[model samples]
Every structure is written in C-alpha cells, then in structure tokens.
Target: MRSVIDIVDLSTEELDDLIKVARDIIANPDKYAHVCDRKKLATLFFEPSTRTRLSFEAAMYELGGHVISVPDAGSSSASKGESVSDTARVVSCYADIIAMRHPKEGAAFVAASKATVPVINAGDGGHCHPTQTLADLLTIELEKNRLGNLTVGFCGDLKFGRTVHSLINALSRYEGNKFVLISPEELKLPSYVKKDAIKSKGIPYEQTTNLEEAMPKLDILYMTRVQRERFFNEEDYLRLKDSYILTPEKLRKAKPDLAILHPLPRVNEISVAVDDDPRACYFKQVENGKYMRMALILKLLKEAGTL
Candidate 1:
C-alpha cells in the first residue's frame, strides 16, 4: 500500500529508479506499451485542470489501461455531498489505481487512507504535487546529465506554488544542490518550507527579488505563474502578476546550457519569443510527464501485486 502523497515519500533512490524506468519506457516504447493491459486508472479530480488530468489519462491509455474519471464535482456523486473516503472506497473496487486532485489540502492523504488500491496525489490544494516534481526530475536528468551540484533558480509565485515546494523538497536530498529563489516579497517562499526543506537538510539558498542578477549563476531556472486564484485581494494580484516575466533580452546573461523550466499554463510569465530559444524546455517537460506517469503506474501496480 505504498502511496505518493508527497515528493519526499519516495526516497532519492526510488526517484532514481523511477527515472530509469521512465528512460527505458522512452527508449523501448513498443516493448512496454501494453504492460498494464486491462488495468483501469480512476482519476478523481475535484478541481479544474488541463495538463495533470490529461497526462494521467494519456499515461494509462498508453500503457493499455482504461480510465474512469470524475473530472470535477459537478459530474460526480460529490455533488450529493459524498465524502472523499467513501468515494475512494467505491472507486477502489473499479480501478486498479487512483490519481486525485482536490481543492483542499491533505485530501489525497484522506483518500489513500481508506482506498484499497494505491493512490497518487495529483495536486492537493497548495499542499503538494509530487508527479509534477517527478516530471521535473526526469527533465532535469535528461537535460543537465545529473541532478546534483546545480544552482537552480525558482522565480515567481513561491508562496502558493505547490510545484516549487515539492521540487525543492525532492532536490534537497541530493548532493551539492543549492537554490536561488527569485520572487516578489509578498510571494516569497514560506518560512516552514525554508526551515524543513532547505535549512534542515543543510541545503544552501539565497532569496532575491531580481531575476536578471541571478541568471548567470544558475544552471537551471524554474519559472511559475503568479496565480490569480491564490490571491485574496485582486489589487495585490494585479500588482504582482507581471513581476518576473522571462524574456530573450534578460536571458542573454544566462549560461548557454541553462535549462529553463515552467510547470506551465504560462500566463505571460515567459515571453513567446523565448520559446525559440534552446534553453526553454517546458514543452519537452510536458511529454516527459506522460512517460514518468507511465513508469509510476507500473511501479505502484507491481507493489500492490495487481500487475
């Protein structure tokens, strides 16, 4: 009954093994195409999504598995006030595994606690998004040739960005990895994240309001949207939304091989002109996410003795 509720739930060794599996899937697609034939994946998305939901469905379909999904509460029994645990208990009977995205924190944990099958936390409010971190790790490994000893810069909404929090927590376990956090003062990385992930692990990090000044020193730059949904005040959101737009001119100071990543649905944070630049690997990241999800499905099913 191993479940991935957080990125750190899987150790560095486990992540490396999954990355190896993902690479094998990428290289030998035909051999592993039908590994999960007749298996079913249940996607219980209590929130709106485009990439995460589609990637999970795509992953299952690619592995020859069927998907039964509740894309949102409007179309599910949740509209009748059904509980997450009850939903999990029922869906477990139908699907080999479950991937959930919810608007409330720890909702996936609640589902996994009662489900008969393995559960993956897709995106739980502002809590964590482990699968996205997995995709990020794979992309970094492919582009940089190694995960450790790189200066990674994270820019934009650090406060509400679950992807930022999860990736930092995952990367902190590696050797010689430091972070340069670039964000507006209001959206700086939370103190709890600073204490647990960076400080407790002895991972060095510097905070900055300037993206350009941090560019040349970074081996990787991860950009994020300043989410309008996370803000209580519309005026504050308007003031900060365009704070760190990454443009071609600003990238002139970066290293030639610096990998630029965005857990995207880019709302003008990254310029369209930057897409032509070799450093922008966000689109490649989307494809890598599907392969990583496929690897994860195989791993979890094997652990559950369902495959």
Candidate 2:
C-alpha cells in the first residue's frame, strides 16, 4: 500500500488531480456523499490537535464513512508503551485507512512502514505535514487561479513551521514561483530546506526581517505563529511569539488581492480586526482544509482499493 509521509511524496500532477477532485466535491457535494459508504477512517493523533483530527473525521462522515479515533497518546495503547508501528498494524486490521499525527518527527514514517493499509501522515512534529500542504495548494489555486508565476511570502516561525516547510517544498515544484522568507534570525528557514527545496531548484528567494517591505510584492502572504510546542525553551518561545502581527495598517501596502493565509491556532500573530478584511483568507483556508482532506481520503482509499 502507498503512504504519504511528506509533501514530496505526491507529484505536482497528483496534487493537481486532488485539487480538481476537491473543487468537484465543493461544487457537487451531494454526488460524493456516499462514496465511502462502508469504509472506515482511523485517526491516531499522539499529539494535541483540533483542526487536523476533526477535519479528517468530518471528511469521512461527509462521505458516509465511520471514524475511529485515538484523540491523545495517553488514552491509547501508547500509554502502555505500544510502538507506533504496532499501533498502526493493529489499527490497519480494523480500519480501511489511517490518518496519524504525532509529536515525534518521522513517527508517521515508522507507522507507515508497518501498516498494511494506506497511511496518511496528518502531521509529524516539525518534520512535515502533507495534508496541510494539500489544503494550502487548494487554497492557493482557488485564490490565485494558478500556483505558478507568483511571489509567495512566508512570515513568522519558519524554523519550526511544518506547514511552511511543506508548502515551500510543494510550491518550489511549480514554475516561476518566488519565495520571500520573513522571520526573525532565530526563526529563519532551515538551511537544509533552503538548499534542497529552493536553491537546488534554482528558484529565486529573498530573506527579510521586514514584513511590510515584502508586502507589496507578494501575491500570497502565508503567516505562521511561532509554535510553542516545538520549542524546548519557553523563554525562546515567548521572545519570538509576537514577532510579526498582521494588522489592517500593515495590509495597506500589500496587493489588494493578496491572499493572506495561516495554518492557524493563532496566539495573537494575526489581529482579529484583519478577519473582516477581504484579503484575510485564513478562515477560507480552514474550510478548504476539510474539502482537501475529503479529497485526499477519497484518493488514497481508491488507490488502496478500499472504496
């Protein structure tokens, strides 16, 4: 069975297909209501999550499928010291597909190695989050009508933002895509990511400490909160947490149609006042997440011959 452990696991063509399916589901929801009538989705989240877990469950239910979930690590067999592989093998026997999130990097890869069924990595620490990348791709496609030939600015927590890392990898594959990395020096995009995903591809990218200066040039502004959970040092977290706050005044110089996106659970990085602005598409990102997740579940299950 195939498994998705990183954003690179899917080719650009496959991503386009998934996006098309998501848009089709959006336009004709009723037609896809019972596509997974007898299937089952098991959500194994070892880390705390609200959006990814619920979005997966909601997607399955909307497809007329059932859900089995392990909401937390302590409540699962992991509490008894069960390995992720063992958990995946056990869950594979009971569910048609598995969606997993864990705080440990490469944890999903370990689970995918053992699971007999298709495994979808929901999120795995600061390593990668392919599903979030799917949601992002859908949002970008819908918002801009194309993924290429546009400048995308990523602000905040670049070091630990899995969503940022994943999206950067995905977008780098598209033609004429430029990156403007905005973050504090401590939170700059990892050198390996820059070398492998951007520099190696010969894609042009600029690093900046100033968000406003990069605003006018961006077609898309992806804002990320400095993740507290990823930090071992509470002091470091506190210091970088409020690094960049997007307000209406900040958007005055940004393109009128600039799509402002966030993989959220915001702790004041984005002003509530910006929510009413037409440029704010974070909520639309949330809704698109469900649809993209629904599209992903359908594709993986069909590939696994479960549907």
Candidate 3:
C-alpha cells in the first residue's frame, strides 16, 4: 500500500526507527532469521547493478525469504516492450514485496502505482535512491555516534549521484547538519535539489571545487564515482571520471575520525591504499546496506500486513 519513492517519504522518526531495527539486526541476526519465513521478494532490475541488487537478494535470503529475480532488463519483459506498470502488476501476484531498479527516472513510481505489494525503489536512473541513503545514514550514525551537528562532505559526481541527492534530503531534516558540496562546476549539485532540499529548509551549505579545502571540517566524507552510464558523451565521462581520487595525501587534512563512505562499485575514486585506514567505512557501508534493507523489508511487510 505504501511505497518508498524518495528518501523524504519516510519521516525523521521513521528513519531513526529503521536505524534502530538495523542495529538490532546487526547485534542479533538469528532473532530475525525466520521473520519472513514464507515471503517472496521480487528483484526487478532494469539497470545493471552489483551492490544494490545483491544486497536486496542477500537481505531477503537472510530473513528466510525466497527470491524471484529478473537480474537485467535484457532478460525481462521490458526488453520486449512491456511497460514497468504491467510488469509490476504481474510481479505482484508472485511476490510479497518488490525491489526494482530502472534506467528511466520515475519507473519505480509507475511500478508502485500499479503493484499491490509495497514497492522499494532500489535505484531509478539519476533520480532518487532512498535505500542507499538509508545505508549511508546507518553508516554515519554508527561511525559518528550522531547524525546531527556534523559537517558532511559529498565529493565527485554530485549532479548525477542519486545517493548524494537522497542523503542531502535526509540529512537536511536533522538539526545542525552542514553540507560541503565538492564537485566540478559541470557536475555541481543540481539547483532544484539545492533549492528544494537545502535552501527551503534553511540548511547551510557550501560549494567548492577543492576537496582538500573541505576535508578538515568533515565528520563524514562521502565519495561517489562519475557514472559512465549517466553521461551521454563518452568523452565527458572520461574527462570527469578522474576528477577526485581520495588518497592518503588527501586524508592528511581530514579529521582522524572522518567516516569515508561510498555507495560503491567504486571506479578508483578511492585509492586501494586508503582501504586499511581506520576511517574507511565504505565496506562497512555495504554491510550496513543489507541490514538497513532487511529492516526496511520487515517494516514495509508489516505495514502491508504481509508479515
């Protein structure tokens, strides 16, 4: 009945509750093993993904739920011209919940409008990715001990980074959160996101091209790759891809406890040498993603009275 199309769809209180559930799941995995004993999760990914797709599947399996998936658009009826709404209607009969990703923005919205089951937007084009924001929130909370009263620096492809956009929207709701937007002028945070999510809420933010200048003040440093898929021209992708590579040298100016996060399948924006740093929490972000997703699944299923 209720579908999560954007990060703002869930209130701050709901976000906190989800984070609490995720932490409990982390502490006691066995307690939730059979929560979805006979439930089915349908993963309908029209776009290519590694982390989001596998994380959703892993979350379902860990909850004792079965998975029915369409791993790619080529193998799905969408390739044969079936609309996303029709696909959702069909999949609704087969699964208790749906996790969908599509290259087209608002594809999940279309699916949610038709599906009888609750729909979770896994990722939709360069638009919203609320689940990734959930993972990011859990990561920040665990690392920083609090989400508010901290400076969060978002680096790399901000314009096309759905994760970045979603996190800004979520964090702006919390008190005393300042945003440091670091990206090339061409890839700066969209004006609409700036106006609607940040400015309208009277949240303070700074725009910069220098990552090093923004480093020292940050409590959380989120790195995002310049997506090749989002770029229409290959030359633009190649030119901007290597813009901000986070190396040990870059972290020299950063805080000792700065939580480094990436909604990854990282394309070398982060140097491998930095992986051993105590501050590096991107892999932790990946693990947290599964837990947050598990929590979300439980909540949505319970809301739909499917659990």
lDDT of each: 0.92, 0.91, 0.92
Off by over 4 Å in 1: 71-73, 228-243
Worst window of 10 by summed lDDT in candidate 2: 67-76
TM-score of each: 0.95, 0.94, 0.94
Clashing pairs in 3: none
lDDT for each residue of candidate 1 in 1-307, tens digit (9 for 90 to 100): 8888999889889999999999999999987879999999999889899999999999999998999986475367987888999998999999999999988899999999999999999999888899999999999999998999999999998998889998998889889999999998788999999999999988889999899999999999999987677777889888867668989999999999999999989979999999999999999999999999999999999999999
Q: Give per-residue CA lDDT, model 3, range 210-306, as digits (tens).
A: 8989999999999988656767788877776665889999999999989999988877899999999999999999999999999999999999999
Candidate 3 global TM-score: 0.94
Clashing pairs in 2: none
Candidate 2 lDDT score relative to the true structure: 0.91
TM-score of 1: 0.95
Better of 1 and 2 by lDDT: 1
Residue 237 lDDT, candidate 3, scale 0-100: 77
